[model samples]
Target: MKISLKTIIAGGALAAIAALAIAAPAADNWENHCAKCHGADGKGQTKAGKKLNVKDYTDAKVQSEFSDADIVKATTSGISDKAGKEKMKAYKDELSEAEIKEMAGYIRKFKK
Candidate 1:
């Protein structure tokens, strides 16, 4: 069997494209699930965000305080204040574990 150089290059290119397609994170979930409260820029400036005191994802100081796992946990399990007031709702029902992790990564991109 003989494989031509063009065939090898095309195969390599296709492999690279496939890898990128699989590695690329899905962000539409973030926009649909979080943008309402987190804001498109993740500034937590929306009306409900203000009411709930949503964390400002764009703040470097705030970003450094929480690890990615913490974000994932909070997103999956939801959050409440010291007074037991609901700060955020649990997404475990609507999002898969992988999706929650990806959303954490999306949140990280807001660090500034």
Candidate 2:
């Protein structure tokens, strides 16, 4: 079988587009996965957020309390209350490590 240069280039472009689609942007992930509780502005002001008593990512003090690793761990493993009640659902199965790291960095940008 012979593949033309144009064909190969087109195939490569399609592959790249597929990869991009598979790996959603951090903001999109945050909006889809976190905005319900964290709010789109990271202020934790949504109704669900208020009910859950979620922290405000826009607060520098709140941001200072956690490290990037902490964010990764929370996102990958999820958070729970002291009684072992689940708070956040784990995303390790849904998100790649790279995506999780990207999310952590994205969260950092919310600090005021």
Per-residue lDDT over 3-111 for candidate 2, one digit per residue giving the tens place of the 0 to 100 score: 8999999999999999987899999999988999999999999999999999999999999999999999999999999999999989999899999999999999999
- Reference-based TM-score, model 2: 0.86
RMSD of 2: 1.8
What 10-residue stretch in candidate 1 is worst by lDDT? 19-28
Candidate 1 lDDT over residue span 15-91, tens digit each: 99997654445477777788899888999899988887788998999999999999899989999889998888999
After superposition, candidate 1 runs with Cα above 4 Å error: 1-25
Give TM per candidate.
0.74, 0.86
Q: Report backbone clashes per prediction.
A: 0, 0
